[model samples]
Target chain A: MSDAEERKRAYRLAPCPAYDIEGTESWLEDMAEKGLVLSGDGFFAGVACFWKTEPRQLRYRLEAAPEGTGLWSGNGGLPAEEAVEINEAYGWKYVANRGQFHIYCTDDPSAREMHTDPDIQALALNIANKRARANMITALIYFMIFPLIHLRGGVLLTAVHMGSGLMLGGLLLVLIALGRTVARVLHLRRLRKRLSAGEAPHRKNWRRRALYHRRSRPIFIGLTIIWLGFFFQGWSNENLGGNIMPLEEFTGQIPFATLADMVPAGERAGVILFNPWIFQG
Target chain B: MPRKALSGLTESMFYVLMALCRQPMCGIEVADFVDTKTQGEVRIGPATLYTILGKFEREKYIEVIEVSGRRRTYSITAAGLGAYAREIRRLQRCLDDAASEESQLGRESRE
Candidate 1:
């Protein structure tokens, strides 16, 4: 093997937990024995082959590149359009093409391999968990904090009066939970897809997800209760006060009520007050 | 010092502390260096990477260095270096013990 090939092998062997070279190689060997020709650029592209099975699987040979060659391109190597076209021709999904290197995945064989890889699935789950956590935190901050700070009345009042803060906070928390649930559901759906298609078991961060859910559930529920109590009180006060008090009565105690009353009395009230003789006649 | 406490750290956080031992690196550069060194063994997703970096910054393990323009860089503090050294020693001791066990096992098998 050449230097590039050696590096590629090393990369392949570097405990991805995503792709299983041994299993993939065995599958490839079986296919080759049954008359599939496996060929590709060892350094840039790892493996490639065409299968003659019932469904007809297309495979791309892959090898890890150290300086980051074709398997995962960086910038300035192959034209993106050309790389995409090539990937399509070989039935590969274009992942990314940067710095002349191109990465692609195949729905047929590549998907199968990926489905069987524990590491890749774990990575995906990790990504999803991270996203869910971030969104949850953001929702907590925005819904819980923003309204508490800058509402018309005040944080506590808004929580009690308008219930806007609580409502908004509840909405945010629910949305975040929903988002996390959606992510988990999607992850499960992917797992199901792989399983139905006869793929191996993949690693999942169920423990972490469970822990996160456990930690967040109480906090979310507590916040909801607190905010809801405040919001309802505010809304009730606003409602009762609105129904009971007329605008005139409501404004009477206002500091600027006299100023408003003086505006519509025709001639300048201020002038008349300053010079009583002018209006006395 | 505590396994439970360390367990709370994400893998990137652990790597970030390791990276900081050499020198402080800005978020982007630290991420890039990790990717390069690991040769893609660890691919830090953008959001996770930034969030962890922010936490570290908040904790004072790393401090912002340059904020000239849109780009901000960070470097490890003295405290961060000390923490990194401690972690390295811990790992080294574990490796040494493991190696010794393997050697003893080999001798026993030969006998």
Candidate 2:
């Protein structure tokens, strides 16, 4: 075979290591700052400049062998053909000479053709918008519904003895609204980044991910209000009996002949019974 | 078989399939054939080409035939041929419509 053909064959046989471009660039830059030399043109083809001499031998080894043959098993090395294929798919041109391979990329009409397709652009946009909306709705539900359920179950109540459930519920709503607004702003920022980069918006769980973060806000606010109510009501005090001994003695002496007698006669019944000592004094 | 017609395939897919249709080739050969045929108009990146090839393999449109030392060779399957035929018919309709439109525009311009 001619020298060119021989080189081409060797290049085709070499294993190409794929690297994420941004990752590789950052890593190389850091290494360069540390006086390390890394060399290669394309994303996957670049090897650390320090390891330039034995590129093949220096390739990182896989912990476990791949399913296929033992050939090209260890190391980040990829077969030349595979490397060329990856480069081509990424709109790169491969030039093989002797034992060396170089990858080149230029503005090609095909790249423009693919990018300018109206259908593809529309599809990408649609996917991103859907993801953003899904996140927003999820955040809203999470912050609102969970607290309401807890309040209904009597597991959470605002203010000891105040019994103003409505006021507490309103405060919960305000907290949730504020939380949702903050979440929306953050989500919009992320969505903008994805759109600008021409990347699809990622949704962890279209249904749950957005809602999960917001749902906790109401629960947290409800818990806080309930705790504050208890704190002010002196529930945490160990000496409630000592603080109102006379009132407690009078209530304890009252005998309920029927279930009806045990029921409060009016809205003022609790206050009248619980604070009788102050009236007597 | 004379290369199955490439009608419905994406331009890159069609060329890759066509390249492998003749003989089992590794990823590089298919990419090179595409570049050669398109006269450097369509360049397939190595990553994109392999990803598509992996999809083709998963869909049973292509299969690995052999591993000659370090070089792996892939051949098109029956389904691949069917896909190529479908793609060709799709392209034919598209071409015919384009031709008719061009002719109508030409006549209009002349008049």
Top DockQ hit? 2
Taking all chains together, the TM-score of candidate 2 against the true structure is 0.37
Tell me the tens digit of each residue's lDDT in model 2 across A1-281.
Answer: 58763332211111111111122223333333444333332222222223222222111101101111112433333334554444445454432121111223223444311222222322333333444345456755664445434433432442333245644654566566557556544544554465456563211222333244335544555676764565344433323543355544675545547544655676455675678775789
Where model 1 places Cα greater than 4 Å from the true spot, the runs are A1-281, B1-10
- Find the candidate with the highest lDDT and give its number: 1
For all candidates in order, the CA lDDT equals: 0.49, 0.47
Task: Give each prediction's DockQ, rounded to 2 decimals.
Answer: 0.05, 0.16
- Cα error, candidate 1, residue B111 (Å): 1.8
Candidate 1: lDDT over CA atoms? Answer: 0.49
Task: Report model 1's TM-score to 2 decimal places.
Answer: 0.34
Mind giving the per-residue lDDT tens digits that candidate 1 earns over A43-145? 2222232423333344432212112333333433332332233234334544432221233445465332322233333333343344444555786677655
Q: List TM-score per model, in order.
A: 0.34, 0.37
**How do the candidates score on chain B by TM-score?**
0.81, 0.84
